[model samples]
Target: MDLSWLIPIVMTAGGVVALIALVAVLARNLKKVPPNKVLVFYGRKHTTEPRHDADGKVIEAGGTKGFQVVTGGSKWKWPILEDCQEMDMASFQMKPQLKKIPNKDGVLVNVDAVASCKIKSEQSSLSAAVERFLGKTTQEIHAMVLEILEGQLRAVIGTMTVEQLIQDRETLNTRVKAEAMSELEKLGVGIDILNIQSINDDQGYIEALGKKRTAEVVRDAAIGKAEAEAETKKRSTTAAKDADVLAANNQAMTFEADKDRDVKKATYDALIKAEQARAEQAGPMAKAEAEQKVVVQQVKVDEERERANIEVQKQKALVAAQAEEAKTVVPARKAAEALVATAEGAKKKLVIDAEGNRDAAVATAEGEQKKLVIESEGNRDAAINAATAEQKKRVLESEGARDAEINAATAQGQKLELEGKGKAASIRVIAEAEVYQAREVGKAQADAIEAKLLAEAKGILAKAEAYAKMDQRGALQLILEKLPSILEQLPAIVEAAAKPMSAIDKVVMIGSDPNAPAKFAGNVPVFLAQLFETTKNLGFDLSGALKKLGIDATAISGPDAPKVD
Candidate 1:
């Protein structure tokens, strides 16, 4: 073979085949589809057209007029009439920087968030829809996602307080998720929320917020604790008071019952005494009645005997009168006889009559003597009976007087005893009242002191909070540095106010070396002296102030110094 002739033919054939293969490769490449991507073709249609299927249902690939969508492949088309675009269905990752303006709190927080999304395989029209509505670039989608995320974050964060945002992370996350869902759903994009990449706020504002929250939490905790303690104390106090009141009521009831019992007992005793007195009087009355009955019987018997004796005496006197009359007649007859001897029988009768007259005078005198003797005897007996009756009456009267005297003495002793018991009861009541008053006064004083101490502690706590929030270390250093000066001035102030400092010996010192006792002691006395000297014009007693600082004359003199460790 001639090499030159064969080379031309070969070259011509190779060029023809090469051109054909190149065209075939280009066509194949055009027909082949990329995975998770789509190509859309529009034919001379500037307006957005609805795509549908053959049955008049909306289609994902072909539009109603002349638009067609090719998914995951390249298609051959007429260059003059067809326009094509690529829509990626692959997962896309984006980080959007978002700025949120807080409402009413003047807080501007910047949020960096990431979003992942992918086109739905079932909704291939998404790319066309996106192309029509938004620019067919990742920048616009990224902007949309950022705007949506930003809006959602702001909407979520704006509804919450800074404290809630800072403290309640879960609530923030939930709220963000919800807001993002609502906003992203409207963007026609499937979204996978990754994370809030970062959040940033002004440093000063964050510090301020932290301080404010800390202060608020501390204050609230303190208030709640104090309230709980106060409530517990109040409940305990109320219970104690109720118990005391109940006890007092019981005591009063018991006292009243005792008083009533005592009164009843006294009444019963008085009744018993009265009954005894009545019994005693009844016995005396019965005895007196018996004596009276006996006396009546005896009197009756004496009366009968005396009457008989008087009758006998009267009969004897009558007999004596008769005998005397007969004697007188005989004497008269004798005298009459003597006279009749002189003048016969008639003269004798006259002499007898004269003798009888003389005898009658003598007999009458005897009868009169007997009558006088009987009368004397009767008078003596009557005198003796009357004397006996008078003696018995006197004895009964003496017995009645003795009983009356005894009763009076007994009543006087009982009255004295009752008065002593009443005096003792009055003394007890007064003592109890004084004790109660003292207890109440002590309790009131204790409560006042507790309140005062609590108020002082609150004031101190408020000052500490303000200082700590302002500049924590600086404020602490300032307080520590000024403590000594404050302590030194206190004694002078007290002395200037004409108050004694003997009770205020313990003073707190700060910024002084704790291990070196002399370091504090040496400076403290000088500070006290300076303070006292400054207030000397105000009539402050320097010596008294020094003494109050535990720097007496002896302490100032020798090696003995106050230890301040």
Candidate 2:
């Protein structure tokens, strides 16, 4: 009776379990794809609709690795029988530090960079990324990106210089990204940011370069300052001389004007006096002649006496004029001599003082000044002689005693004027000499500074020109351009090296024979050492670079080539 009741309850529970199992199987077969991810279904033994061309011909193609990928959609798969894989479409970051990378100039540098990479958005890109990196962790993907970027960085750095790395960041970044573009595209990785965080050097080369440039700038500044100072000094000296000369000329003009007015006034006074004397003498002579005529018969002796008396008056006037002329001439001559002596004494003292204090060049300049002064004195003496001759000629041409007296006064005035003019000219000459001396002194310094600048400019310009040809891109261009020249010099280098080998008496293989593997391997380092030695004077290792490019340097050198066998 109990068994009959148990059968009904067990049958109801079994029916409920079967319903739940069917629902679970249906749910497990269905998959929902997210918007930013792809769902790949493979090994499901299913086929999509056949693709056709315009003619509707059936062209069935199998998916790669028997895999069908559906992106951003749902798919069906057997639960626990097929595998499901997922790849995140999110961005990833890769930070890497490239260390001690040698640049084009052989400078060691380091670059720390950060890059943001992601799977490309296209369906094909998703397929590629899923195939290559579907199971890889986020850290693993980042590591792969770093490895790719490091490889590209090494290649780019090999072609670039330290300056380009530091200063040409845009070009450097572009080159780095371009270098990894094809590889990343193949793997469906898109680089969003290839940012160079920092670039530095292990050596103090950059700092040293800055210091060198600074020193060069300082030297140029010092030179420019000295040149400017010299120019200013020259201008100042020239302006000073011009001012002094102008002042001397103005003073001479003033003196000459005063002398002219004084001479004119003295001549006018002398003429007035001469006219008065002529009037007074004319009346006396007429009276004497009339008396002589009247007493001609009675007193011929009286007439002679009258003539003698007129002659005596003429002689007395001449004697008085001679004494006055002598008085004026002697005093003027003595005063001129005193002034000349004083000027000579002043000149002598100045010259002696200058000689004691100044250099030999200054003394030489002073001597030139003295010569000019002496020549000027000779010119003044000639002028005086000419003035005296003019006075004598005027005296000889005189028609009367009054005219003679006027002529004498004019001559005396001319002598005074000549003396004053000579003194003023001497003073002007001395002042000009001093100005010239100072100018010469300034000019010497200017010449020295200019010469030094010119010499340094030439040397620096040559070096600058040589260095300017060494820009990273330009240097590569030059290497390509000068390849022929380098090839041409190869023969000469071989010849020189051969000369030393020819001088050597013997060569012996100590470690192993020529055909030995260890000997052959050992020769590579020896040959490299010899090559480096050969190129040491050239400032670069050409052979090493060529060998890295797969060039046979030893073969090129021929008989004189370093042994590598």
Candidate 3:
């Protein structure tokens, strides 16, 4: 209603237009060549004639209908009016397989090589590239340059040996570049690098040459070392002879010094023994003088000893008399001391006996009192234990009664549960049997109906075929026979309904008023109506036969009809 759907449509249109214009601008402006690349644009042919510079080189002052080469800067080329192609001014690498190139040694070698090339930035070289490799990519230009360099490498290898190619690689590079230089410049590309990466031969000639030269060098070195060793040995022999002469002269000087030292040692030993014998003679003369002085001193000592002996005899007689007097008095003194000791011992014995008697009496009384206390405590503990046992006995009896009650209840519950399970099992079995019997009877009835329908359809088909060919009478006969058989089952169906009346148990009277209509044999009329409705399911109209038989089908349908079981 607001026309809001137009907003996105208009915006998308504008955005798409802007995006297309940007893409077009990009496509045109993308033709701009950088400083490192040369762009050749010639679809419009801005140049027509070959022009020249001051050096008489064919310069391209692009104004006529011809190709023009641009080195840098943007060019506004209209769409579908001009086209531009680029040539790389930077180096490009190309590897080439150079096989079976002969060398100066007449050996065939396999060589792998690489080439680097770029477009020359000058007007003439740029013009040449526009004329030649203008639409060529970097790889295409490199492949062309590689082909030229590969030919040049083969020519250079022919002039040089394999050893020169391996050892002096820089010289090989110079020759290869010089050979390829002019040809590449004509194609408007310069050679920045030309390298021979490897060279090999199936015969291993290069390896054999290197080994031969190395062996020659090794032989020369061994010869030089052997000559130097001989010269060194000659100088060593002369030096050893001079060393022997000097050693003999030093030995003669050592022998002369040894003889002079022995003479001085012998003279010094003789002087020491003469001095020892003179000191031994002085010892005995000193000992004899000491003994003569001791004999004079002993005579003076004997005179003093005789005077001292007479004084000692007088003192000994006085001491002997004093000893006789003291010995007689000492016996009576010992006897008195013995009698004093005996009386004191008797007093101590009496004191110990009294203390022993008192301690024994106290211990007997305490023992009797402790025995009475222990007996009373034991009696008290026994009474308490007995009381606790009686209370425990009463509690156990009560718990036993409660447990008996709980067991009785549990047994009663289990019995009730088992009885309920038995009743439920019986009910489930009866219901299952009823359902099985109903299903089996229904299946048998369906099979009989289906067989009868099939036979009737076949008869109708046959009669229709017979009527279409033979007559109309044949078709009418099958209809008459099917009609009478169907009418015959209607009376039997009615009897099957009334047959359940004999099996009824009780029919209760349920009504608001006792004077109201009765419901005796109530289910029979509903069963008869259902049985009548069931006859309509067969492929026939039961009303023709029912009306001819004069049965009141309406009386079985209404609500006030008499009920029969």
Candidate 4:
């Protein structure tokens, strides 16, 4: 009876429940994409518009079984018509450790690197990333990225040597990132930062190389130190020698200065004495000049008297000569004129005769020259004809003689060859016999020499053994004991030198110095000192030996001895 009122109440409640159910369904379909995430809705009949590519080319899209992507924004799913998924777009760091990877040089190395990777955020990249990594956890994405990075890193390391890996880490990182990004791009993954942290090898080659470089540096330092020390010593020695030379030069210069001073002093004294002598002789010289002038005047008066007498005699002789000339000159002049005219006539006659003879001689010489030229031409022709004929005869004779001689020589050569062969055989036999005899004799001599050498070697060995056993003092005593015998041979030294000198006819000591004998005597001691020095150099220590014998070694071989020049 109350059914109508209950029906209205039930319908109102049913409507309210239906509204709440619809709101809940709408809320469940809505999704939010955080700044670090991307939302992807994929199902049938998507409502997303087509996107323009980087070149602004339009793509036909929508109304297809495809996915819609929303990055850092909100997106709604059309319940049952589409399903939604979220992809982490946030960057995460991954450490990729590649172990025992062989490089270009086939050296096994381990590489460790840190990389930051995320899903691509670009429209096309985001669509690609949503298709690949949609609904994946951050850890799972990190693992996938690490694997890709490690594979790319191994590929990069295989292209480089351990040295390049160690020295060029930046290049390693760049190449690894490039290769990794190329591969990850297909998976819609991007690499933001990639860094190679360390590269190492199990082998100790790098340590050894460092050690070798350090050793080389040490060697250079040692060589430099030695060279510097040698240079310093050389400079020191040079300075010492220079000081000695300078001191000697100073001493010599001092001697020269003393000598010059003495010479100047003597020269001044001599000049003063000469001036005093000149002063003392001046008055006497003046008086002697006055007396000499008086004598000169007297001599001049005597000369004038003699000159007057001579003038008188000359005047008398002149008068006599003038009279004689008057008596004889006219006739003599006439005779000379007659003789000159006759000589002139004879000269003309002789000149005419010479011309006639010259013409006759020239004509005769022309005839003789023509005759000689013709005779010479005839003789030359005859000689040429005879020479030609003789040459032909001689050639024929030489041909005949050559043929005969060749035949004879051939016959003689055969005979001589037979004889030479016989002689050679005989000679060979004789040489063989001689060689055998010589070999036997030489063998015998060699045997004897070998025996003698062996004996000598044994004796020498015995002597060496004995010497080795003796102390230094014992050896010196033995030397002292044999000193007299050694001295007995000393006369030979004098004789050896004097024998050559004795063969000379005379000794000519020709030197300008008066003290040559003294100098030669002085050189004898120097020579003796040099001789003793030579004996010491031969390991005898002659001065020490002499000192042990209580002899004064200083005279010849001690510190006081004269140095050899």
Candidate 5:
């Protein structure tokens, strides 16, 4: 191959290939432009036509039909016939500088705030309409955004004071959001929020307002404190007045009570005086009545004395008349006696015969006395014999009684012996049976006690092991101290056994010894003394036992020991 000829041909081929690649790139770029941007076509007329609903209902007039809105991607169109401009839908922050406009209160304040917004679809379409009407540029959009936000912000700031704008940010923000949102919505744009970032005002005005509020608060507090003090004083005054009124009432009541007491005293005194006067009159009136009665009784006595004197005089006269009559009858009686004497001689002999008969009667009585004497002697002899028989009978009865008594006594003794022997045998049998039973029981109890003691010992060993491991000297010391107390109770056990056997012979024979075992001879006293000593040393109680022994615990310590009696 010839190198020189091949170089020109290769260069020509490379140029052709490059031209093809350029055309392919231009075609690819044309395809890519449709996705990245949008195109809007505007006709000669700037006015928009009315839009219609899908249901053929008439809607508001909007952008002209020659103009079209393209969003998100590009559109294929004649470049000469349409103009395409990109209006961003993304949010943007617009800080608008606004001049101080006086509020309703005529206070000037500079309002600084931020507005967040995005272009609306309808307003973006209106760019084509605006190009027809005014022109198409960012300047118009920026002017529109600023014009809307600035008018709204100025209106908001003008409605409020500088203090409100500064302090009440939330209220300011709410006003901004409302006004800006409504305005932006009307313009087919979206506003996120309108914030009053800051407000600049005269410091003197703010400080004066703060001082005024503080003074008002302090004045209110002072007024409240004064009112509280006044209320307390009023209550104290009222309480004092009430106390005075109560004291006066008590004084009045006391005076009334005293007056009542005086009235009662006067009434009691009058009653006593009247009673005394009546008592004094009663003795005088009684004396006068007694004197009148005595005078009447004396008159009756005088009348009775006069009547007695008259009766005595009448009796004396009657006695004298009877004596005269008796004296006259005495002479006649003497003459009659002389005549009777002659006849008496014969009468004397008859009287002598009567005297002899009387003597004979006397002699008969003497004979009767002798007969009575004989009968009396016989009766005396009979009485003596009867007395002798009675004495002999009494002696026989006494002898029989003695024999009967001896027989009865012998029988009673035999019966008592049998009964006593039976009773003693029964008691001995019962005692033996009880002892046998007790021995069995004691063996069983001993076994139980041994088991319990073994178990306690095991437990004590376990506890001691634990205590030893822990080195607890206190527990070991307590057990050692208590050992004597347990041992001291042994005497009580013996006493309990012996107490039920008081009727048994005092000299007990143990192990077939007739004489008491040496150990048993003084065992009770020795055991008791040992128990007392052990209990005393162990601090065990023996006051109850000392009482039974008729000894006072306090007295037993000295020469003043109580006497056994």
Candidate 6:
């Protein structure tokens, strides 16, 4: 009975221990990748990853071969088939120091730089990193990166001159990064940053360069100061002459204007006087014409009165002759009738007497009528002569007055013409004088400006010579270093250039395009292209710098970019 109980207890105890050991082994094999590390599981491998078609349908249940990698996750290793290892993904800082590296200028330079590198997180790069850096300490990783970078830095410095090394370290840094990245990629190492800390030469070349630059700058400053002073003196003298000439011109113009005003005033006064005299003459001439007309009418009335008197006298003479005829003829006829009735013999003598008396009366009446006709003819002739004489006198007086008026007008016109000629001659003389003064002043100013411009051109030529000596890449790198500040100021420059648009109160667009304003605003991007183009012209290719940073310059400067104008 005791033996049977012991066997069950022993078997139970053995089963529990085996279970605890299995749990311990399983826990140990289940590895979790650290946040800053990669866990690689190696041993039994597969040929390929899982494959898919266009529609994502599984074409093959592919498996990984050689080694499988995990970054920041947990994975259980096959107990007998696979083993797990952790690779440090943490970054390490490096200070690569190169001693007496010979540069392109044949000068030995020592360069010091700081850099940070880490194992790449990309699958291919991580696999490459896993092969070399597996189980490697952080110090070992730092040392490896330092060796790669220092070699690259040496090569980069050797390609540059002493002046470039001092003035353009950024170019050195960029080339080092570009060159080192190719070598480091083999070991799956990536450079986060590479900056040159210091550069110096054993031969004291940099100090000499600095001293030479300082002397050049001082010489340029002195020359600039002298040129500026000379220019200032020339400008002062020119300005004084210009001021004097302008004052003289102004005074001449004022005198001419005053003289013109006075001449015009006199001309106007003469015209007014002439018109007033004409007006005065017009009234008197009209009155004289009316008086002449009245005289003509009075002459007509006197002629009419004389004719009436002549007619009245003729009528009275006719009446008296008729009465006489009636008295003589009637009495004679009555006497003849009385004699014929008394006696035949006495009737003949009485008839003869009556006939004689009738004849005498008829003759007397004819004589009276003839005398009245002669008197009427004389009076009518006298009246006609008087009227003709008055008319002739009035016509002569009118002709004399007209001739006098014409002479006065001709005299006034000649006086005005002579005065105008004098004034014109005076104005011409003054204008000629002012023109001469202006030409002299302008010529002097031009001479001064030409001298100043020549001086400026000389200074610019000197600067251009200095800039021409710089390497294109080094200049570009310098520009790129300041590119951030330049970009920051671009908006301000563009806004300031467009400031005139703010002064416009209204814009009247006359085009078929509705996006005119948008296109106008889009010029800002085009201005960026123009700025880049201008930099390129100056041997600083900003586009090349942008391309190094993995930016597509073509995309930034598109084909449809608006023109700045």
Report lDDT per candidate. Answer: 0.57, 0.65, 0.60, 0.66, 0.56, 0.69
Model 3 is weakest, by summed lDDT over 10 consecutive residues, at: 270-279
- Candidate 4 collision pairs: none
TM-scores, one per candidate: 0.30, 0.35, 0.35, 0.37, 0.32, 0.42
Q: Rank the candidates by lDDT, best first.
A: 6, 4, 2, 3, 1, 5
Alpha-carbon RMSD, each predicted model: 44.2, 54.6, 71.0, 41.5, 47.0, 47.1
Model 2 worst lDDT window (10 residues) = 394-403
What is candidate 5's lDDT per residue for 1-565, written digit by digit as tens? 6599988899999999999997775554342134333345454344656767799875566554546555555444443554544444456678887755676577766667788876555544345333432334656666787788888887887788766776788988888778876776655566776777766555355567767878998999999999999999999999999999999999887876775675465345434433443344345446744764564455445434444544443344334333433343333344334434433543444345444544554455445445555667676555445544544454455445544554554455555555555554565555455545545554555555455545655564565456446432453354346546644754665455345346556542323334436534444444344334433333333443455447665443333322211
Tens digit of per-residue lDDT, candidate 4, span 261-345: 7546534543443344334334444665576556555555555554555555455545544554445544444454554455455
Spell out the clash pairs found in candidate 2: none
Candidate 1 stretches with Cα past 4 Å from truth are 1-22, 25-29, 44-65, 73-83, 98-100, 104-106, 124-130, 133-135, 180-187, 198-200, 203-565
lDDT, candidate 1, equals 0.57
lDDT, residue 285, model 4: 46
Count of residue pairs whose backbone atoms collide, per candidate = 23, 0, 7, 0, 2, 2
After superposition on all CA atoms, how large is the RMSD of candidate 6? 47.1
On the 0 to 100 scale, the lDDT of residue 389 in model 4 is 53
Regions of candidate 3 where Cα sits further than 4 Å from its true position: 1-30, 45-65, 137-139, 227-565
Model 2 TM-score is 0.35
How many clashes does the backbone of model 3 have?
Answer: 7
Largest lDDT belongs to which candidate?
6
